[model samples]
Target: MSKAIMDLTELLERVENDRELIRDLLLIFKEEFPRHLQALRDAVDSMDGEKVAAEAHTMKGMLSTLSATSAASAAARLEQLGRNRKVCEFQEAYAAFENISKKLLLQLDTCMAEVGG
Candidate 1:
């Protein structure tokens, strides 16, 4: 099997092994991720470099919190591209980030089902 996107091991440790808290945080991430993704996409589509940087930074923070390293790195790259005013240069990074994020969302859904159900 492939590695999971949202690895809770580090997060679980940081939270003192509170599984419930982990579940709650993951739920929050699940609820808000789509909106963030949409905003990022819109920013990219509009070639708004500032918006792209801001959205990508926000995404980086969120993914980092969940220990989603690959996605977070992708987000960081997107942010850097935006910072360089290279919005048009972020197609590859954005695509990779989007793909990873979708996979993470699916993993989160499965986790939430397992924990919240």
Candidate 2:
């Protein structure tokens, strides 16, 4: 099997191995991520570059917290496109971000299942 969606070792270390805290944060991520993703999709579809940047920035922060580096970078790309008001470039960036997000969510779900989260 592949590795866990996120390697929480560092996170746990930072929290001194507080398992409950880790669980809580993961649960919050699970709850919030889908909504954030949907908002990003909506912003992209509407060609609202500013909104896309805002949503992507938010996603970047959340993904960074989980150490999902590639996914976070995908979000960052979208954020940059939005910041630059690159409407023509939005489609490809949005596609990449969306694809990465789907994979990331699958990884998250697998990890959550393993942990009985």
Candidate 3:
């Protein structure tokens, strides 16, 4: 796993503290993550740093709530890059977040399955 998804280990600890919280997080992931991705895709397609930063900030907040450290950090970096007009860095950060997001989703699937969700 990349550094972006590494915080999932800590998130797992949270899940143990409250199954309902995990369920709530899963719902947010199902709902917000897709929208976050679309915003990112549109930002990338348009090469709009403003939109990129907005989307990255949104993703960062959501990922932080889920305790997805690596993804959140990646998103934060993208947001920062966008804010700084560093398009190349933003693009790289977006790619990193994309990878981490996929891995997180897959891991979530397994977690949900284990709980018969």
* Candidate 1 segments exceeding 4 Å error: 113-117
Error of 2 at 67 (Å): 0.9
Model 2 has an lDDT value of 0.82
In order, the Cα lDDT scores of the candidates are: 0.86, 0.82, 0.76
Candidate 2 per-residue lDDT, tens place, 34-96, comes to: 899889889888999999999999999988887778788989999999998898888899899
Following a full C-alpha superposition, what root-mean-square deviation does model 1 have from the true structure? 1.5
Candidate 3 weakest lDDT stretch, 10 residues:
1-10
> Which tens-of-lDDT digit does each residue in 6-76 have in candidate 3?
35456668667565677667776877788779889789667788888898999889888778777788889
Q: What ranking emerges by TM-score with the best candidate at the front?
A: 1, 2, 3
Off by over 4 Å in 3: 1-9, 12-16, 114-116
- Residue 116 miss distance in model 3 (angstroms): 5.8
Give the lDDT ranking, best first: 1, 2, 3
Query: Which model, 2 or 3, shows the larger TM-score?
Result: 2
Tens-place lDDT digits, model 1, residues 1-117: 868987766767777877787788787888898899999999898888888899999999989988889899999999999889886687777898999998898788777665553
TM-score, model 3 to reference? 0.81
